[model samples]
Target: MVSPMITEKVISNAPYAASAVTVIAGFTVKDWGVIIGVVLTFITVIVNWVYKHRQDQRESALFNQKINHHQKHKNN
Candidate 1:
């Protein structure tokens, strides 16, 4: 039996496939601009959210350490 071969060229052409479909569907320059804007905005929001979450985690850890240290010294 002969199996299908999936190569790098085929994988890289995936974007072209989407472009072909969009072209066939008559997407204009303005449509592409809106799509690009929305994608960039979504990516930016996700990056900021991830950064803020990590910062909060770090601050919480530092606060816990300070409380623990103060308690230890208060008892001495």
Candidate 2:
């Protein structure tokens, strides 16, 4: 999917950057429960990040639509 931030100045090559960062950051399999718990928490963070991002997007879209609709009738 095309990112919402790509422009003429910067490519915003995010998938490649994300994979590279994930690999370099060493977010991989672990041997112990404590280690796994840490990884799970990290995973939780990523999940929450994506969820909040999408939620914010939805909320903004709804708010914009509401304002547009309200203005359409209020201008009459």
Candidate 3:
């Protein structure tokens, strides 16, 4: 007996990069889940890096302000 094939609809502009995929090569649903997970993890890492960079810039500005204030007081 032949097994029934599954069909999924995909948008042309989907992030997966493919309009449609046919799974005749024994690629299972589990494999697709892993691929998606990896992509999401990469995106999360980039977002975290940007957030930390902004935080560091803000801290540096505050530190510079403190140093300038102390220098002005010492000169007076």
Off by over 4 Å in 3: 1-20, 23-26
Question: Candidate 3, TM-score vs. the true structure?
Answer: 0.64
lDDT tens per residue, model 2, 1-76: 7655666325557677788887757744543567878899999999999999999999999999999999999999
Q: By descending TM-score, how would the candidates be arranged?
A: 1, 3, 2
**Scored by Cα lDDT, where does model 1 land?**
0.91
Error of 2 at 25 (Å): 22
Q: Using lDDT as the measure, name the better of candidate 1 and candidate 3.
A: 1
Give the CA lDDT, 0 to 100, for residue 6 in model 2.
Answer: 62
lDDT of each: 0.91, 0.82, 0.77
Rank candidates, lDDT, best first: 1, 2, 3
lDDT of 2 at 28: 46
Candidate 3 lDDT, tens digit per residue, 1-76?
4333322333434545442444334567898788889999999999999999999999999999999999999999
**Model 2 spans with C-alpha error above 4 angstroms:** 1-31
Better of 2 and 3 by TM-score: 3
Best by lDDT: 1
lDDT (0-100) at residue 19 of candidate 1?
94
Question: Model 3: how far is 27 from its true place, Å?
Answer: 3.8
Task: Tell me the deviation in Å of residue 12 in model 2.
Answer: 37
